[model samples]
Target: MTGYDDKPWLAAYPPGRPPHLRRAFSTALDMFDAAVRSAPDAAAIHYFDRSLRWAEVDRAAEAVASLLIARGFAPGDRLALCLQNNPAFVVGLVAAWKAGGTAVSLSPMSTEADLARSFAAFTPSALLVLDDLYVDRIRPILDTGDTGVAVVVTTSGLDGQTEDDPRIFADVDRRRPADTVDLAALVDAHLPGPGVLAALAQRRVGPSDVAVLAATSGTTGPAKGAQLTHANLAFSAQVYLDWSGLAPGEPVLGLAPVFHVTGLVGGVCLAMIAASPLVLTHRFEPAVIAAAAARRRPVFCAAVITAYIALADSPDVDAADLASLRLRYSGGAPIDPDVADRLEERLGGYIHNIYGQTETTSPSHAVPPGTRAPIDPDSGVLSVGVPVFDTVVRVIDDDGADLPVGEIGELVTTGPQVIPGYWHDPVATADAFIGGALRTGDVGFMDADGWFYVVDRKKDQINAAGYKVWPSEVERLLAGHPDVEEAAVIGIPDEYRGETVKAFVVPRPGSTLDVDAVIAYCRANLTAYKYPREVEMVAALPRTATGKVLRRALR
Candidate 1:
């Protein structure tokens, strides 16, 4: 059983998923075969100005492989993909794999400094950049910094396109002196038929090799690449697919960025998990999403809380009758109780809570498929659900001892789904893992029923006037009130107390909410020190892409 204690209601882990296929994928290259096998023309991927079937996508990837071979790119060499959410992103990634190199995904929105920092950390030999993003911003940083990349390739104008000017996509291969090779021509030459044997021979790549280079701020501090084997990614994809229980060929929406784990796994890996067709709203535009929903009606979507909030408030949002939707899930941050309730009220059963971090690849927790919890009980619902398909959970103390039922402690996880360590940082990895379990750096406790509750980030705890207060607790209490629409609690600096609790609230529509009443309500639910000493009413609370309340931003 995933998290089942001796509880009466929630039972053991689902039976379909056994404790098999752990640390499974040695590489991610298998998804391409799976995609091609499942549906050659299943509307495999839809993105900017183009839609590709499985067969077409594979051909393009093979072309990318040939181009790398022509430049003498090696097997273990790294390739940085510094592009926004576009079809080229997938082509570059898959192509890098076909060519036997690792693709390092870079956030398109990252500043030049961050981009340079990332590039230097991995020392990718080449980069595939999008024309839309400010690629020039990172160029100066690369020239002045360490780890100078050898090759620069433009992905623009690759969709069967070529102009007389030919200025677009003039590949800058240092190995090939004179002019860069045309990528489109390379791909056209490799069209998957009798002529394909020649192209495949040139690239000479296959499975059992690393496909993606995953980098994150490792536990110790500096950025390090995880070296995700193709098997690891394939295993993660399989685990996520089972977690959702969606049909194999269902249409899923990709409305998030491709840079982060959320987008890569949810938007890319998960779509290929079961070879599902994907509908992409690349840049996450609210109007475009509404338009897509009105027209295409994708069956499933993996999104964050910010998108939910925006859509909920949009003039076009008609929760009563959403089109082409099987499930709507939000993660990346805690979902406010009030927001959750309103979404349920509007969209019927549109909102579900997913919980995970970059470490888990993507989501390791989600509401049960048929959960009947109400939105009014949001925090009660956000409690991380049962362990994922092949994951394990444990709550422990500083001495590395496991705590009993209902005891609060640092959440530690151990399972095939959890990465044992970060890239190139043994010290950080040692500090993070205890007895083979990764310490999540989150404060939480599991009830006897096996439901896990996230208390807060251990670092975010506040000491107000010598009393310990958790913002999640206070905010949860505030959100439960009928008049409160939304609430965010943070620590405000105090001369005498060191740090005082401050509550920023948004009142519900058609309610005259006052501070005295709110403070009085908190006083009834929380201890004296836990009550907000200062309350400020605002139009809205600041949030991240996934709807996580940006408590650090509140002044």
Candidate 2:
């Protein structure tokens, strides 16, 4: 019955591990500048057959900041970016922060309608989209005149790529959008100029200022923006950097997408904090990750469970490619214990499980490196692990009272890394956060040993391929079809993804609507991960006493 302030997990720390982190840096930009000054000539970023040193990255970020300012993006403005894991993503992220603006990350897989919804909600002043995606994705949204964006910058996936690389990049002249300017050409047009360096020095970002606006779904339906401050990003990065035990100029693998919080904090921000070189890949292909591991021999990497499964199942991976791996991290989705055991056997390293939300900025609970998690005797659930430095976790009941150990209840957390509130959504912010602690909608309990285990999810959200998919959002889209009378969506257990989206639809009387047509209609409006892969046609949807669809019964 003791409070978590006792920090019982400190007893489980590896020998000589510090109890907490000092968190020396004030902001993410400050950390980045310190890394550049400490190792100007050291490699900071690595792509196919090419590398960018710390000095080069700093100069490029400065030039991009100047371009943003000249394009009418003032301090505290929102800059939307739609890109994958590449050099351009990092460049744009740092540039926006340097210009004292908040960066908004959008999924590259989002359809035109999906993009339009987000753009209208956030009302970003500027946009940075991939060159090839601009034509099919951005142009349609811009034509509607819904977004407030006035300036658009298109970046090539092949910029700074080696000539020997295998991927095909579009020719800038023939395929480039007529209204947008090339990112590389803009940088070349502005860099090494007097104004660029002066602007970089003049703009000042504070620790409490909002640095990033990450999009996340709630139970209500559409995605809401989580306003993360500079201190939130800085502390999260420093916490993991100390946890990984990597040194300056070390090699780290960046396989996760930079847009997500895990990759943004663990992959990019952690590398900057440690002054390490991040080996980048455009997407998660087993062969490419295997080849990069063989060449770079990275010391650490983070990804979802499916990615680890793909690498372990691939024929190209072997002991040599993973020999240098000291620690591995898995987040966004739950990892089966058997899968973790098998992957550890292959890589000779423990795969730690991290638990957090987009609102937490990345991780709040993580298994200490080199240690294995214990299984609960009664529930048979594997513990996610103990809280990291300066974090407190408690299980609360319906009345906000602390529950005893082994009791299932809502998980609440408080720490420096937690975001203050949701962007422009006071109702959601007030509903989710209570007394400075985030009321995480996860039903879990803590053990006497201070370890935490997730028993179930309180929110009716689906984790498909490590992305949160709200059932209500899909139901709204499904109800729009003429042939559909009513719809209900639920998550079904999946082996590869933790869960897959499944829809139960009621066809209009005397109207013929198959599963294919329903899925196609959803695919045209929703993002790739949010679409329902399996559809069931029923005579009518099950209703409750009040005439509401019973999602639990459908499940």
Candidate 3:
């Protein structure tokens, strides 16, 4: 069997496409600068009813850098962004990088407890938040002194959307807080002062500087931050753009959430680096996406399997709506072979399967554009394609030795795009990454022809709605219920969600706990995607001789 150490996948690349990146940028900032210099007046972002040119985005980011510097934020400090797929999200991140601060991307769906935990862990000096959506959650966290957040910049979700958009809802005062600054006002403020510009010029970022604190579930439990350097983000964007053959000024759909790695790197960073226009909307509705695709004629889009399924099932989607699409890619979750075929049959284009974790930045493996993924003859599993430019994938045994091709073992990756390590957790960093390679905890194999296939996952994590749900966190929450004596959670096959959490519970002695009660209890304590959707009650949970729960038996 041919080994992958030589990157055999290069042979399978599309005609005329190089197997490696020919052009390089030292950092993502450099890439953005190049795009702005190349096309100052080109359309950079297309929001609901408003469009922002490259000049506008650049000036706004500079103002944000000035604001951060004026607030005493120094290099290496962390700035958290807790918004959705809005222009503010991009501006804030770029500004943070410009001011030499590491930006942290947080999901807008984070609960009060979730925000508090992250704030305590990262100790961000400032936050850019959606005013109407998360004011309450942020207020309490700030009051507790756990997050160390001194500055807060709030923006309305309707900043660029048409006034009649249904997604916009007002829950709190839109007025700026007495202490916090308004993002819109900052952007409209005069250009950077002499002092702020001086500070900005003095702050220099390099390829090795930490650029983002991407959140991910560690090997065993709770979410930990991954320290992705500027080089990691820059490499991911350049590789994706080059491999997809996306031309500058082409339109790409902004369907993925900005908080997710796929959106941050693939959608925003790729669009900026390619000098392409990113068409954006507030939410992911099938009808809306179809309408936008028909109107704007986007050439590329990357989304999860569920989004593709939704588009296929929607009545508004037809041949003309998808005619503009040159390429479509699926990430965040695995798509079944049958489902993938069904999508292609209905959507008129093949959906290439891309694989990566937050720890690997955004994408390490993707099928080359215009190429169909091959299926494993023995297992009938669809291949996840090949490693992108400059990436190395290896299947290894438990002892960290390379396994022969076609043998299923853990998949480890090493490349410029991989994050340096987990934030502030040396133990986790040591356990998850070894000798510059990340143990992906996925059991997969590569064929002699350089095609890769996934068999199963070694980690106890669920991908509900493309969100990582650690079983242990849910199990711990269930065990805290008054009626639950013990609980074991496992991921079950789900047609819509890829995988949903199912709990096997044992009731406390003399206590009555029904399935509905267990579900409701968990729904109250956990987030929507993290809660167990199905529950099973048993007399006692199966345990090993050492009194440990046998999760496999539960499954």
- The true-structure Cα RMSD of candidate 2 reads 10.0
Candidate 3 versus the native: TM-score? Answer: 0.82
Candidate 2: misplaced stretches above 4 Å? Answer: 163-174, 217-220, 460-555
Write down the RMSD of all candidates, one decimal each: 5.8, 10.0, 9.7
lDDT (tens digit, per residue) of candidate 1 on 175-292: 3212233345556676455554465555434444555666653322445665555655676777666666777887777766666667777778777766776776546656566665
For candidate 1, the TM-score is 0.82
* lDDT per model vs. reference: 0.67, 0.80, 0.81
| Candidate 1: residue 307 Cα off by (Å) | 1.4
Please report, as a residue range, the 10-residue window in candidate 1 with the lowest summed lDDT.
160-169
Give TM per candidate. 0.82, 0.82, 0.82
Superior by lDDT: candidate 1 or candidate 2: 2
Order the candidates by lDDT, highest first: 3, 2, 1
lDDT, candidate 3, residue 533?
A: 88
